[model samples]
Target chain A: MSGSGPGPTAVPTARRGRRTVDLPDLVARARAGEARAVARLISLVEDASPAVREVAAALAPHTVRARVIGLTGAPGVGKSTTTTALVRAYRQAGQRVGVLAVDPSSPFSGGALLGDRVRMQDHAGDAGVYIRSMASRGHLGGLAWATPQALRVLDAAGCDVVLVETVGVGQSELEIASLADTTLVLLAPGMGDGIQAAKAGILEVADVLVVNKADRDGADQTVRDLRAMLTLGERRDGAWRPPVCRTVATRGGGEGVAALVEAIDEHRRWLDSSGERARRRVERAAREIEAIALAGLRERMGEVRGSVALGALAEAVVAGETDPFRAADVLLAQL
Target chain B: MSGSGPGPTAVPTARRGRRTVDLPDLVARARAGEARAVARLISLVEDASPAVREVAAALAPHTVRARVIGLTGAPGVGKSTTTTALVRAYRQAGQRVGVLAVDPSSPFSGGALLGDRVRMQDHAGDAGVYIRSMASRGHLGGLAWATPQALRVLDAAGCDVVLVETVGVGQSELEIASLADTTLVLLAPGMGDGIQAAKAGILEVADVLVVNKADRDGADQTVRDLRAMLTLGERRDGAWRPPVCRTVATRGGGEGVAALVEAIDEHRRWLDSSGERARRRVERAAREIEAIALAGLRERMGEVRGSVALGALAEAVVAGETDPFRAADVLLAQL
Candidate 1:
C-alpha cells in the first residue's frame, strides 16, 4: 500500500501524463527503428503510464516479428558477457539487436567497477544495437510483470532480435523461459559442485546449456556433470534435449559460440515449425495481460489498505467477529 | 485470452460455490484446533473457493498469536532435517508446531522422493505437530498468494509456532522473509563456492544463518566465507547482524540447534521491541489482502480472456489499430 494506490492515481509518477495523445507517432517512430522512441515506450511501460494502453495498442501490430532470446545463469556465470557476445553475433548477421538486462545487479550504482555496461560497450557505438538495463527493484510486480511489456516494446521497435538476460535465481529463469523463444542457461567451471543446478531447477528451463568460461579449470567436468544431469532428466525423445556448449565469453574468441548461435537458430526453426512459437506468444500475452490487470487491482487494494472499511474488517476478523473471506468480500464490494 | 477472461467469473474454478454457506462451521472448527478443519480451510484458500472471504472474516480475530519462522536453503542443505530438529526442540518446550513446506520439488510426480514429507515424518504421529506440504506447482501466484492464507489457518489452529520452509530458489526466500518474524537461512559445506549466497541475495534476508552439515569438510570455510560476506555487508551501528551458527542436523545433534533457537527467539524479541513486529504484521496483511484482490481480478480477467470483447481488443491491439494500454483499459472497464 505504500507504493500502490487506487486506480489511475497509482500510475507511476513519471508516467502520469507526459504524452498521452502522441502514442501513434511514437509507435510509428519505434516501428521505423527509432532508439529514442523505443526507449520512451519502454519508459512508459516501466512507469505504468496511463497511456500504456494506447502504446500497446499502437505497437501490437508491429510486434510478433522479433526473435526473442533469453539468457540466464547463476550470478558470476558471465551472463552479461554471453549476452554481449550473442548481441555481437546477431549484429554481425545484419540483424538489429536489443538487450534487456533484467534485474541488473547494480547498473544504478555507477562506479569504476560497473562491469556490466563496461564489458558490453562493444556495440556502444553501433546504431544497430540498443542496450537497456532494467532494474526490477523499483518496478511494480518485479521482473515477471515488467519484462514482457519491455519485450513488447523491443519487438515493436523493429529489433530483429532481442536478448533478455536474467540471473537464474528463483523464478527469474522460469519467467525468462516464458518470454524467450530460446533460453540459454549458462554455467561455469568449478563454480559449484553442480548441486546448485539441481536445486535451482535450471535443468527444466534450458533450451541450450552453455558452459561459459570454458577455459577455466574443470570445464570438462562441469559440462559432463551437466550432460549427466540432462540425461538423468530423461527428456523424452522429440523433446528438446538441451545441447551443452562451451565458450570463453571474455576472450570473445568464438569458442563454441557460433555453434551456440546455430543451436538458437535451430530452436527458432523448431518453434516456428512446431507451432510452439504461436503457443508461447499466446501464453506470454496471457501472462502479460493478467499481470497488468493484477497490477491495477493491487493499486485499488493499496488505496483501500488502511481505509476505515478495510481496517474495521481486519479488526472484525482479528476479533473473531467475522472471517477473512467475508471481510474481504465486504472490502472488495466497498472498493 | 486462453486462460484469463473479463470479470469475477474468472476468480478461480474451485470457488464456484462448492460450499458457500458453511463458513462459520469451518471457521469454528479451525479455531478450535481441528487439524481437518484447518486443512479444509487452507484447501478453500488454495482452491480460491468463493467462501475464502468468509473464512478470512471468521478467522481474523483469533489469529496473530503464533510466531512464524521461515526456514530456507539451497537444495541438499538439510532444511527438512533442520526443520524436524527444530520441531523436536519446540515440542520438548511444549509448543504446538506447524510446518508448511512451500514448493515441494516433486508434488507433480506424486511419486517417491517426496523428500520433504519423507524426511519430516519423524513427527508424523504427534498430535502436537501438524506438518502440511504445499504444492506451489498447481497453486496460482505461487508462494506469494497461497502462503499467507495457509499461515493464517495454522495460526488460528492454535499452533504456537509455524515453520515455513521454501526451496531457496528465485523469489521464494524473499516471500518467506516478508511473512516470517524470523528467517533462518540454511547452508551446507562443500555445496558451492559461496557465490550463490551473494547471487541469491540471501545475505539480505537472513535473520539467522545456519551452516547445516557443519560436520562435513569445508564447513569451516563455508562459515568463514559467510561471515566474511556478512562483514562486507557493512551493517551500521545498532543493526542486527545475522549470526552464523554451525549444525549437523542429520545427526539430530544439539551442536548449534539451541543457539539457533535462541537466535530466533532473540530476533523475535527484537522484532517486538523495535516495533518491527507491528510493521511486519501490517505489511503482511496488506500483502495478503492485496493478493486476494488480485486473485479476484485475475479470475475476472480469466472470464474475459476468450470473450468476444477481449478477443476483439486483443485483435485490435495485435493489428496496431489500438495499443495494449488502451485495450487493457477497455478490458478493465468492461470488468
Candidate 2:
C-alpha cells in the first residue's frame, strides 16, 4: 500500500541538511490535536509548497467537513471583537473552533494586525481554538487559491467549526462568501452602512446580518433600514431569510454572542433540512477543483509568457500582422 | 482575398429580422472618424459579442497604437474634472482624445454617474472626442477581459490619446495601471490621502502624480508628504522618477492642465528613449493574450462544472474518497 501510494519521486524530497517532512506523520499529529502540527500544515498550504498536493492527499480521509462561517464587514465595524467573541462562545460550548482572518487589502502575509493579536491572546493557551491571518501576497487569484486549502488543514485537524473573517471590500467579500457555509455581513449604526451595503450588493451574500455595537445610538434605525431594504428584494417563499442579530461585541461576558451563536445554529439547521448543505458542499468542492485546474493552466501559460514563441506572436500583433485573438489562439495552442 | 480572411462562417450571422452588423463596414467608418461607428464597435466589445473576434481582425491593420494614459484616485479626488481638463487641453492641441471611465464598484453598465455626465458635457458636441463609461457586470474577471478589448476599439478608431479613468480602490487601481502606457495617481488636500495611497500600494504604479484641488488648504503639505514617501522607495540609478504636478482642475482656463500635458509628453519621450514603450507594450500584449486564453479555458471549465463527471468528482472529494487536487486532475483531463 505504501509503494502504491504517492511514490518517493512524487513526494518532495528534503534539501541537504534539512529534516524530511513526513506528511503522514504530520497529519497524524495534527489529528491528535497537536497545534504545532496543524500550524505547519497550514504554513505549507499558505506557501504553495511543492509538497501541498501530497499533504492534501494525506489529510483527505481525516477531514470531517467542518462547518464554515464567514464574517465580513468594512474596517472598524468591530470585526476582530466579534470574531473573538464568537471564538470564546464556541470554546465555552466545548467545541473546537478555527479562525482564518484574511486581509485582502494588506500585501504582506502572516503578520496579524496588533489589534487582532491582542484580541486573539484570549485563546492563546486554549488548544481547542486556532487562529491565523492570511494576506494577499500580490499574486493573481492568490486568496482564492490558498484560503480553501488552509480551511481544509484546519478542518482535517478536527476543528468542528471554522470562521473566516475578512475585511469586506470589493471582490474579496464575495469571494469569502462563496467559500463559507454561512456568511455574516456585519454593520454598525451611524455609518450609513445600510445604504452602503445595498450599493455594494453585499446584502445578497449574507446568510446572517450582524449589527455590531448595537448599544450605540441609531442601532434600531439601522436594523429597520436593513429590514426595509431586505424587503425590497424579492425572495422565494421557502428560501432562507438572513436574520438580523444585534451584538455589542466589545461588552464583557461575550454580550449578545450567545444569540449570534444561536442564529448560526439555526442557519445550519435550515441548511441541513433544506438539503442545501450537501448541495453547497458539492458546489464548493466543484469550485475548488476548477480553481486548482485553472491555476495549473495559468502556470503553464506563465511558462509560455516570455518565451520566444510568445514574443514573436506579440510582436506580430503589435506590428499589425495579426489580431490579438488570433495571437492568443496561437499561444493557447502552444500551451 | 476576402475568403482568405476570417471566413464568412466565422462572422456572427445576423438573426432573422435583425440588421446585420457589417463589421467590415463599421471598421471602415470608424477609421474614417465616424463617432457612431466607433460607438457601435465598442458596444460589440463591451457586450462580448460573438462578432468580436472578427471585429478585432477587421480593426487590426487600422490601429495606430494610441497612447494610453490611466488616471486613478479615490472618489471626490477630482478625477473627472481632471480628465475633462486634460481633454480640453488635448483638443486645443488638435489631438483627438478618448475617455473610458470604468466603475468597478457599480453593478450596472452603460450608466454614467450624473456628475460624470455633467463634466463630460464640456465636449458633448465634439466629434474629435469620444467618452464612454464601462461598469463591472459581475462576471469573473469582467474588467480584465473587457477593458483591453474596449481600449483596442478606441485605439483602432484613430484616437491620438485614450485616457482610462478608474476609481482608486482595491484591485481596480492596479488593473488600470497595468493597462496604461503612463499612470497618473491623483490626490487632494485634507483626506489624509498620502498615507492612504501608500497603504494601498498605489504609489508604486504612478508614473506621474497629480495634486488636484491644489487651491485647497493643506495642498502643499499633501505634496510634501507624497514627495517624502516617494523618496523612501529606492529606484534604479537612471530610472524615471514620477513628478508631482499641482492642478486646480475645476478652475477656469484649465489651471495647470498644460503642465500636466507636458508631463505626460515627457513621460512618453522617456518611455520611447528608454525602450520601455516597446517592452511595456509587449508585456501588456502578453497579459492580454493570456487573459483571453484563460477566459476561453474558464468557459470550457464552466461547461464541465455541473456535468455528471464533475458532480461525481466533487461528490467523491466531499466524501473524502479523494483529494481536490486529484479530482482537479481528472477534470482537467476531461477538458
Candidate 3:
C-alpha cells in the first residue's frame, strides 16, 4: 500500500547483504561518549537492509537494560520543553540518556535545507546526552518500528535511559502506543477536548496523562474535565491509574514528575504480572506474521497472473455462465 | 506487530493436507451475488497462515479483471453522495456494478446504523448491485489483506465495473491509489485547505481532482485554486494527465464524470504498450511472496516468546551488553 512513506519500488540493485557499518563497535564508542558513532549508527539503522535488520535483531538481545519512555503530544504543546527537563532530571540522577526526537516533515525537504535541522538547542553539543531527529518519509510505522530498534542501539551505547519524542499529528500518533514502555500523553492547559483528538482516538489510551504548561490560566479546569472523562469508566488495567500530573516544565516547577515516571514503571510491572504483556506479545507476533505474509503475497502475485484458465474463469463469472462459489472451488482445486 | 484484529495468532493445528475453508466455492457464491459468501471468503484469506494465504496467492491471478475506480476525501465532504450518483450513471450506461465501501468504523456499529448510511434508493434492491463495508481494525496495510482476494470475488461475480469507496481516514485512502485504475479526490468547495486535503503525499497521488458541492458559492474559486495546484508538478506516472471535475452530486448536476473513467481505461492500454504492466505485475508477485513470509514468521514467533534464550537476550540488552542488529538476527534465527 502506498501510504505516507515511499513504496519498496526503489530497488537498491546492490546484492542484499549485512551492512558494512560496524553497529556494535559504534555503539561501544557511543557508550564511551563518542557522539559521532551514535549519529552514524542512527543513520545506518534508518537506511538499513534486510540483512542489517537481521543483524540488529540478533544483537538486540544483549543490549543495555533501560526503561525506554516515550513522550508524545500535539505539536506546540511543550513536549520538547517537558523532555528537556526530564533529561536533565535523569542526568542529575547520574543516568546517561539518549533522546530521539522524531519529526518526519523535516527529513523530506532537508537534503538541501538541512542546515535548519540543527536548530534543536537542548543537546547540540552535549557529550553526556545523545540526541537525534528522523524524518517520516521512510519511517514505516513512524517511531514504532524505529524506536524499538533504536532503543536497543542506545542500550548498547550505554544510555541508562532512552527518551523518545513524537510530534503527535492526528491519527498517526497512535504509533506511540506500540513503542513505549510508559507512554506519556502530554496535554496543555485549556486546549480542552479538541475536535481532532476525539476523531483520532487518542484520549482513550494515554498511559500517563500530563497537564503541562500548568502555570497558564485554566489549567485546573482542563485537568478537571480530563479527570471527569477518565472517571466515567472503570480503568482497563486497574493496577495502574493514569494519575494526572500538573507540571510547569520550563521553570522546572514540577520537577518531581519523577513520581509519575515511577508510576509508569509500576504499571509496566503490573502489565507483565497480569499476563497482559505476554498477551500483547503473542498478538503482535501474529499480526507481524500476517502483515508480512500479506505483503509477501502481494509481491509474488506476478508469477501466476497469466494462467489461461484464470481469464476464462473470470469471463465466465462476468457472463453469468458460472456461480462465484463453484468458480472459487474450481480455482482452489487447480491451485 | 498485531493491533486489534482477528488475525491468525496461534499456529494452525489442523492437518496441512487441505485448507479449513473451501475458498473457490465461497468465491463462486460471492460471484453469484451472495454477500455472506463474499464476507466469509475474505475472512479465509486474511490469515496468519502461509497455507491459507497461499490460496490467496493462487487465487489473485484469476481475479482483478474489473476497472477499479477509487473515491475518497475528507469526512463529511459527501463522498457517499457522489458515489451514489456515479453508480447510477454507471448503471444507466449498462455496466454491472459492485461497490466496496472501506469504512474504518466497526462493522457492527455500521450495520446497526445502516439506516443512516447514504441510501441509494434507485438501486437499493437491484440484484446487480452489491454493497459491502470493510472495517479498518485489521491488517498491517490499512487496505484489508483480503482486499485483493475480495476483488477476485467481485471480478468473478460478473462485475463489469467496481467502485472503491474509501474511509479516507488515516492512510487507508492512500492505499486506494495503488489498487484502483482511477482515483477521484472529492473536495467540497469553501473548506480551503483542510488539514486532511492539504496532505501533499495524497494530493500528489490523485488521478482526478473533484470539487464536490460545486453548486455552493465560491466553487469557481476553489476550482481555480485546485487547477492551479495540479499544473505545478510533474505527475507520478509520466503519460497520464490528471483531470479535474466539478460536481453538484445531490442534484446530479455536472454529473458526467465518466471522462476520467475512459482516461483510466486508456491508461491501462498505455501501461500495456510501455510494458509497465509487466513491471507492475512483477512487483505485485513479490508482494504476495512477502505477505506469505510475513504470516509464517508471525505464526512461529510464539516458539521463541517464552524461551530462556529470549529472556536471557532481553536481559542482556537491558544490561547494555548487546546491540540490536545481533538481537534481530538471533530472534529471527530462533523463529
Question: DockQ: which candidate is best?
Answer: 2
TM agreement with the true structure for every prediction:
0.60, 0.75, 0.63
Candidate 1, chain B, TM-score (2 decimals):
0.87
Native contacts present in each candidate (fraction): 0.39, 0.73, 0.13
**Per-candidate DockQ vs. reference:** 0.22, 0.47, 0.11
Q: Put down candidate 3 lDDT per residue, A162-186, tens digits, no spaces.
A: 8877777754456666555567888
Interface root mean square deviation per prediction = 3.8, 2.0, 9.6
lDDT of 3 at A119: 24
Q: Which segments of candidate 2 are over 4 A away from where they belong? A: A1-19, A63-276, B1-18, B68-127, B131-133, B136-156, B163-269
Task: Provide the interface RMSD of candidate 1 in angstroms, 1 decimal place.
Answer: 3.8
Estimate, for each residue in B64-154, the C-alpha lDDT of model 2 and write its tens digit: 4789999999989999999989988887888888888888888655535665576445565666777877775535365677787788888
Candidates in descending TM-score order: 2, 3, 1
lDDT of 1 at A157: 69
Error of 1 at B326 (Å): 3.8
TM-score between candidate 1 and the true structure: 0.60
**Cα lDDT of model 1 overall?**
0.72
- Flag regions of model 1 displaced more than 4 Å: A1-34, A104-113, A192-195, A232-238, A312-322, B1-295, B298-322, B330-335
Error of 2 at A195 (Å): 9.0
The true-versus-predicted C-alpha distance at residue A296 of model 2, in Å, is 3.2
Alpha-carbon local distance difference test for all models: 0.72, 0.81, 0.58
